[model samples]
Target chain A: MTIAPDRLSPFQDEFYSALMQAHEGLTEAQSHALNARLVLMMANRIGDLDSLVDILKTARSYEHG
Target chain B: MAYDYTPFPYVSPPGLTAPEARHRVVIVGAGPIGLAMAIDLAQRGVASVVLDDNNVVSVGSRAICWAKRTLEIFDRLGVGERMLAKGVTWKIGRQFHGAEEVYSFDLLPEEGHKYPAFINLQQYYAEEYLVDRARDFPELIDLRFKNKVVAHEDRGNHVALTVETPEGTYSLQTEYLLACDGAGSATRERMGLDFTGQTFQEQFLIADIEMDESPFGPDPVPERWFWFDPPFHAGKSALLHAQPDNIYRIDLQLDVDADGKAEAAPEKVIPRIKAIVGDKPFRLDWVSVYKFRCIKLDRFVHNRVIFVGDSAHVVSPFGARGGNGGIQDIDNLGWKLVAVLAGEADERLIETYHDERSHGSAENILNSSRATNFMTPKTPIEALFRAEVLRLAHDQPFARKLLNSGRLSVPCSLEGFPLQTPGTGAVPSGRAVVDAPINGPEGDGWLLEQVQTGGFTLVGFGDVQLPEVDGIARVGINQRSADYPCFTALKGLAIRRYGEGRAYLFRPDGHVCASFTAPEADAILAARARAMGAELEPSR
Candidate 1:
């Protein structure tokens, strides 16, 4: 699911751009490794995965619907 | 008596004549954690009194790195912007073996948080900011400095404390006491809690020095610079951190015995710096020798006295996580205390604090140990392993993981918390949807943006209305454009992917409470009521 640049709010664009820049030079494997760690770290920070899953499913449905 | 014939120059306020009845909650320390608890309590309309022995905030540097999550908390308190303005943001960090740069990682990319990359401001400045904020709530909070808790007796209903003030001794009665009183917590000791952990074998020297020549390469960035190799103190590592005012805080591992007890001298540190940077003139600002230890109280709370910050847990400062972790402990406990005090939740919520925060502390200690293991290789075999890992990190993904895992500044969630339900079905990890750019209905940033509020926030993505509980606040976002105005300026990214009719409830302290599809209002309210510990029926 690719987020469209035009649809992104100002802060969104800045964050997306920065994130891309952070991963710019890394290979796919490196990026994936970093992403996996980030996923766990973020999960820990947010603390509730069941709720987050509900959020993700809702977002995905919104896109597909 | 004869001289008293003249009227007094000034009459004190009526309330001043007698010490106001002791507050319900008395925080024994006015350090950052103590002040933070006071602020949180005051915000919840809970009366609190904070007492500190020191008259002035500490002058020398202590903790340097403020994690992204902490910055978010500061933002809620309206001080994060000022901190971000004064502090340096570091996103990229490099690992060194001797003078060689081995592995580098970018911390900014994967952290969907809307705050800056990690910020570096001296611990004193952070405390000063918190103290200044506390001054605004004079009525709700009483901040007494130079007053020490000489004695405390936990009476069944209230804790009676005898404090020494400049004038004389006075007695205070408070329902609960919080010890934010550093590692040498008298309250913790008084409660007879056992602190369990191991202390490092060697001692470390920390110095704040003004370098005449920059040790950083051209296009210098503020990062954790590590030097791992011999001669500069064999089997020891040096860390250079750029602080404000052109001062750099340097940490050097020293070859000293467990009983080594020497004050950090510039002569010893300068010669070591000369070994690495080749004889550059520098001025020493402050220096201290510290022995690293990893210890945590068996329990965080005893009777009515609770421990926060260093009193509860102490970890090595290798990852710069100790003080930051300490602040987070209070942040997690603050709201729970409010809930318990306000009768919004049961005392059971307080027990989860130790369970969750101890887990976090354990993780932080683990990460710090990893960094220490790599930076200060104790054994020759370990040294060889570190060297080989660094060499492979140049091209290998696993090497990057080993190196990046050492930084360990990410916030841990409480999904697996014993008190939390595992959920009826598969839980969404929030990773796949993280990159999507969906905004809140009111144009607030996104799911990540809401996490910064520093408490439980329930985000209703659709037009669904949630039954209100006393302590919980519900925000409904229905705007098609993901530009919620409330969170437009915050530091986290917007969620770009989600189903239209979904809603999520977040726990106070920035954890997800629960999520649901379009459900009957009754079920949602019941779940919330149970989670928040509200009586099934309203009180008459």
Candidate 2:
């Protein structure tokens, strides 16, 4: 199955800069907390259940440590 | 500490001593929903005969959390101010994890709305208000107590029902039969429809404790406090809500192994109350232990027999959706039934009631079930997810938004509805009319009060000209002497909401049916017809 990317990521660079700035002086626990918060915020903005489920599956589809 | 349970005078009914003329509408059950349904019907000029097995209001402080939208609907039904005066208004909710505050949210941060985010009034008071309001329509509302519906059959055009009165049993007929008969509905049971959904294994002890002292310390503003893992109830959820007359509703999640009988006893409940309130003097006003469920019928409309309120659907109490959702259903269905009986719209208009309300009910069930799952995890993995969310909520604003301690009920938008004429603005088509303070012919009133005056309203902003449409009331905002009723938006809230030179058409139920940058006669007529569940004509 293919899901075309339709997110408003035109300001991806600025968003990324702000995201990094949000965790500038945070420890490991604080950084993880920030990321979790970011994920939750983005998920709420994208309220469609199917889209959220697909996004979750896509995120888990990759390998991470 | 207990409320004085005033029993309504139950006069014995004549049942079918002599076959009376067919009732325009017959509503079974005189609970809040049934009473509201009758009142809504009466306001739309349709009379109803209300039958109830019992002649009293709810005995307990059940369904205390009346949502803002429900209060708005209650306003239209002529009891909003009374409920507001008697109810504890609260908007902020605090969520705690293990005796530590994780997050808090304000439900209605915006202003200019008439009702608060939520009002904690006992269901008995709500029923009393509704019943009293129903009495105002003495000619329209025929309330029969101790008259129980034993059997009913939808006879295509009408429903023939068997009634059992205190005197004797008799049969009668009604044009439209509304089964407002609650969750344990005898009507639903007789229909052989399965009311099935998620029934949790975890039981909750619901108790109303009467005390003058505030558990949250001095000067306690009424607010909801939900605990994911309070110290008193480790690993379980606890909830506290303030109600009118110094009564407080406390719900503690009980283990599946917990005895229902023992948990309800004062000896056992008092200890749990002590753990939470700590030596606080309180009397047990009411106590019950039960599991919650989310369930609904496949189809609400079956010929002339229609199911309203809990007879049609039920959701977990966590979200305050049960009574609130039923009131919304009554609000949605009342007008269409009025039109159908009056021959203004086709009987198909009644189907939209099912279509739109089923959507609302399903969303309520989904949200309530999700909240229930988060509160009572059925598995270790689920519990871990909930715990992590709560922990993350302590530090992350986004996670706090994700914390769903039963997201309080709101009016469901009918977006993508067949009736809606789409547009762009704050007041979108299919959305409920947002209340704004306005200076009408009378000193002052809310937008909803004005909207409640007439049939489908065409609210025009700033000299927007509209074509003459029958059965459509025209209201000019910020414009006077325009051959229509005019209102000066006191704070310019209504004008700002609809934008300049734009017109929004609201359905009879206060939902926006269409919006027009410029009012077009043919288009407006088409939308109006479609709102009545008639298909659009090809010519238009």
- The number of the candidate with the highest DockQ is 2
lDDT of 1 by residue, B453-539 (tens): 544555555444444544445555553343233222223223223344555655556555456665445655655555554532332
Against the native complex, each candidate's DockQ, computed on alpha carbons, is 0.02, 0.04
In model 1, what is the error at residue A34, expressed in angstroms? 33
Q: Pick the candidate with the highest TM-score.
A: 2
Location of the lowest summed lDDT over 10 successive residues in candidate 1 chain A: A1-10
- Please give the distance, in angstroms, between residue B309's alpha carbon in candidate 1 and its true position after superposition: 1.3
Candidate 2 per-residue C-alpha lDDT over B1-540 given as tens digits, one digit per residue, 9 for 90 to 100? 567778888775555568778888999999999999999999888899999988889889888999988998899898999999989999999999888898887999988888989999999999988999999999999999889899999987899999988788888889999999999999989989988888988899999988999876788998999999899988889999999889889999999999999889999999999999998899889999999889999999988889999999988899899999999999999999999999988888888889899999999997787777668766444555566667656655555666767878988999988767677856778898888888877878778887766489888887788777877888888885788888898788878777888888888889998888888889899888888878833221
TM-score (chain A only) for the predictions, listed in order: 0.61, 0.77
Docking level for model 2: incorrect
TM-score (chain B only), all candidates: 0.85, 0.97
Model 2: lDDT of residue A53: 86
Tell the DockQ for candidate 1: 0.02
Fold similarity of candidate 2's chain A to the true chain A, as a TM-score = 0.77
